[model samples]
Target: MQQGAEYSLDDHGADGTRLVLSGHLTLASIGPFDRAVKAIDGPIHAIDLAGVEEIDTVGAWVVCRAAHRLSSEITGASPEALRLLASVQDIDVDGPMRPPRPPVWERVPLAVGDKVFGARSGIYGVVAFFGQILIGAGSLIRHPRRFPIKALVHQMELVGVTALPIIGLMSFLIGIVIAQQGSVQLEQFGAESLTVNLVGRITLRELGVLMTAIMVAGRSGSAFAAQLGTMRLTEEIDAMRTIGISPVEVLVIPRIVAATFMMVLLGFYASLMAIIGGAVVGDLTLGIPFWTFLARIQEVVPEHDLWVGLIKAPVFGLIVALAGCYHGLQVRGNSEEVGRRTTMAVVSAIFAVIVLDAFFAVFFTEIGWG
Candidate 1:
């Protein structure tokens, strides 16, 4: 059976009123006890708890709150009850409800600095990863047995052959759009035939290699990061290291080699698809016919344009692979980190590719290959 609880107010001779508490002063008894306490008017001089049969933290808090409000003392509390009351006494029920936040303007400089630091750290990691991949490549050259040929073939199939459909479709569509737009502009000045020159040169010199790099970065680079990040999380990388195996040789080098070789092949394929698309668009819309379009492309789009685009493929591949593996190796703990690093890998690879392409454009132009 639960015990009953009560609080009684009695006027004292000199020291004001005494609050007499009795029975169970606990969670079960708090409702009636609290109501009885609240009914009393004026300040309480003292709290008499000797008649309290049982007490808990909740009961102690009630008594302490009443005493604090009335500015009175507590009498006849046992050691445990007294300790509970003492602990809750200093608690600031009237304290600030929420912490103050800094103004937006105050946070701008700090945010900028943090981003700068993160970019610097990422650059350093990528450079170190590139150097490590180089070392692994050299080791494979010296010790052919240590080369991961199967892994290389598998990655090539995944990163190159598997990605062909999407790369081809995207390039083809881009070519159609470029040709259509170029014809619209060129027709105004009676230069509709120049659409062939526009499509061929743009596709060969820039779009073919650049677009393929971006797509591969989004596809293969993210997969590389996710694969290695998962391995790191599961401690598989650690096991490899323990068994005297280098992760760079087994995991990193194969991916680097696959990406580097495949980019050239995929870029060439994209250029072909883009040219075909442009020819189809010209035949249908401009009535230029496929043979005429191809002949014009061959005549106008120089050999240097194709060479310039193809040469950038391997470098772009290396950037994507390095970014992906670098972030993957940086993964530390959980599935969340894996996802975060994968996204970082794709973003970093794409950014690096665009910046490098811009530099290559300036470089090729400076050498009179523009």
Candidate 2:
């Protein structure tokens, strides 16, 4: 009674079907094994592998897959065969499903912590940039010939000269609005003539420099970030360093100096334009002559107001340039990072300008500038 490479299904007297597996129960016997499994008319009741001469993982897989299809008692399998079968069974079994996700309320603290740490890192980066710039300035002072005169001139033209028309238009409209609104408010108190004082004081002391700084931050600051960020992505900055060039000196100092100087000129120009616009509005709406409006401004607005605004312009410019350059240097990876850094540069510059303006306001007030 020789057992070949096959499986036999036999029925006992009213007993359930028995699967008797035989010789070389490996890949070579796959066809017979599959056919024998399929030949069972009903579900398997018992498995007898005592007759199987040899077995492998493939044969074990066939047996495991067949066993899962029916609730049957397996018998006479050797320890090695059983171990292989168990592994195959484990491979075929699905993993337990994952538990439900946590609620968003549980994630709030994590989000807040992330933002706080990010902001702290940003502050540290800005401080480090300031220190680097100072060191670069010292080096340039020692070697005046290394100063980037051409880059400074180019940045001045880009940041100041090219920005004139828009700055003029915006300042002019703001002055007109201030005059018109002041005239309306003061009319009830028979102080309509004071509209000149209102426009002159606000424009010279705050709005002129403040508005120009914001515009420059949005325009040139973002441009600096995007430009440097692109250079960084292309490894141009690395190339510069490889050739013994200092990026802080070549890329940063020129921009900061240019913006600071240009801002002074632009702020002065913006203030003058705004005052002229106020004069125009007074002449048309309040029936006051342009000469009278100008005279009233000169008489009522303290020279200290003009001095205060002029003093703030350079500081605001420095902040804008530093913020832009710092974020630009921080750029990593790809074009998307360039866009993100540009946005961050503009926002950080504008916010710093506003905060500095507030500090100046307090200091001036405390010092009896009014």
Candidate 3:
């Protein structure tokens, strides 16, 4: 009538110990049983699975290991006892070990709330992040000339040069839309001539550079995090450290430089393309012509606007690289960690870019640059 079963630990021979387990050897049983077996000494260990009514692979591994271990020390028990321990399958076992069990959620943190990020935690995490960067920095300092010029060139070209077409295309389309929208409203008021004003202000004040930076952040930031996270998970970071290479100078610095340069270039391309798009729409809707639209844009948007866009580009670049690398360092395990980091990289990069843009917007506006 009783549902619960008991397991016993006994000493059989003078130099041997025995564990008589009774109950379902489920996940719960594995821990205590494993611990008990571990506490034994001197190589004389015998485990009696006869009392274990039910057994799982994990439980079987414990018994089999103990039997194998005792066989090695106590002589003749090796082959036979080891075989029997190995053979303690559900069908062959004499008694079933039955233990009450619950789900593992109690022992594990299931959600974001489980992720602690308090003052100490933040300080520790920041410390760890900087520590990794320091290792990277140290590697750079030690090697001095081991720079992977080829890799750096490739990353810059891919993240920067190749991004030009898309950035230009997207910015152009956006400008066209803006120009069309403004032309529609302005024409009703016989203010169609102001299409250039609309386009120039929008591009210089916000759209052109911000949009380009956002695109680059989403593209390059995710790439960096995914790449580094994969490397971190695979112990490549460890290997680099063991080899005495600084990850900061070798990995982070190059990425930062490449992205910074790339973003600046992309920002320029996006601005130029947007201006062209605006001119196209202006010529058609306002009957103003491309050259006129361009001249008007030049007249209205000062050299300072271009400088604003250019300056914002590198800051956004820094945000993207820092976010990506930070998230990459957050990675702990396998492919899942890489994906999590990549998502974090993108989300954080965009958020940071927007924050930096807001700061720039206010600062420039205050200084009469807007």
Candidate 4:
């Protein structure tokens, strides 16, 4: 068994009190001594540790804490005890254990300022990166031999062809829902036939391209971020740089080009599938023939609607690709950073697509395309 610590207070007339501590001053024996020291109410001029048989960091901490509290100096300490007490004293910070909580009024403005600064930085980074891409494009233009035709083609297959099935299925289901919902609402006015116009105009003008952009952001955008982030983590990007390769030209440019070019086709294909889906619903429930519904769509959906979707497709694709590549290039430190950047890429791309889609809607409406 360990010997418990003991202490005694020795008072001298007009000379102040001396606290004398004895026995094993260790974690297992310091408890009663700690309590006794805290209960001391008289002024202490010194603490004498000559009687301490053994000491550890925990006992040193208790001794230092009491010395600080009583404004007393420690005395008669052996070399080891003195060193331990000095080490503990050095780390004893004179402050609150936790920081004081700020007032709400102060905290709110500080948070807002941080977010604004972060957003400004992000915008600057994106613009600078875009400029780099333009420079790369110019380099390619100057030397057509450096064009990454094979890379572009491979990215096209990855970004466009592989995504067709899921995009098609999603668009088809969306079309069915739109048609079904439109029929229910139009039936109230005995104008169920107008469901054709609703499905045709909405799908071709807005839903087709918008939904496709969101899906592509979630799928291909995340993939781009993850791929680039992994390359950064593995030092492959650094190795390429060391060997005289431009990562932007070899990796980023091809992805951006592939997404931008393929979006036009994907958007168009998605619109077609949605129209087919609407036609299926029309045939199954509204007594309209499938082929007849398809034919009617061409007549009822104005040429401007198709033009609207096509115009937005490439822009949305570019935004998604840029967000992904920007976040990917930002990945650093560890594998967790890759996942974080990938999620940010997808979220930012989708948000940008939607915001731009709203802007397009307003612009197109003002230009008589509404």
> lDDT of all the models against the reference?
0.91, 0.89, 0.75, 0.93
Error of 1 at 10 (Å): 16
Query: Against the true structure, candidate 3 has what lDDT?
Result: 0.75
Q: Model 4: per-residue lDDT, tens digit, 1-370? A: 8889989888862567899899999988888888888898777999999999999999999999888889999999999998998788976546689889999999999999999999999889889988989998898889889988999999999999999999999999999999999999999999988989999999999999999999999999999999999999999999999998889999999999999999999999999999999999999999989999998988898999999999999999999999999999989999999999999999999999999999999999999999
TM-score against truth, every candidate:
0.78, 0.73, 0.66, 0.79
Model 3 quality (TM-score)? 0.66
Candidate 2 Cα errors over 4 Å, as ranges? 1-101
Predict model 2's lDDT versus the native.
0.89
lDDT of each residue in 51-163, candidate 2, tens digit only = 88888898887787677666666778999899988878776433446767668897888889999999999889878988999999999999999999999999999999999
Alpha-carbon deviation at 228 in model 4, angstroms: 1.6
Query: How many residue pairs clash in all the candidates, one count each?
Result: 0, 0, 15, 0
By lDDT, the best candidate is 4
Each prediction's RMSD to truth: 5.6, 10.3, 12.4, 4.9
User: What tens-digit string does per-residue lDDT give for candidate 1 at 1-370?
Assistant: 8887887777854777898888998998798777767666687889999889888888888887777777789999888778888888887655688988778887898899999999999778778877887788888899999898899999999999999999999999999999999999999999998999999999999999999999999999999999999999999999999999999999998998999999999999999899999999999999998989998898999999999988999999999988888889999877999999999999989999999999999999999999
lDDT of 1 at 257: 90
Give the lowest summed-lDDT range of ten residues in model 1: 32-41
Error of 4 at 259 (Å): 0.2
TM-score for predicted model 2 compared with the true structure: 0.73
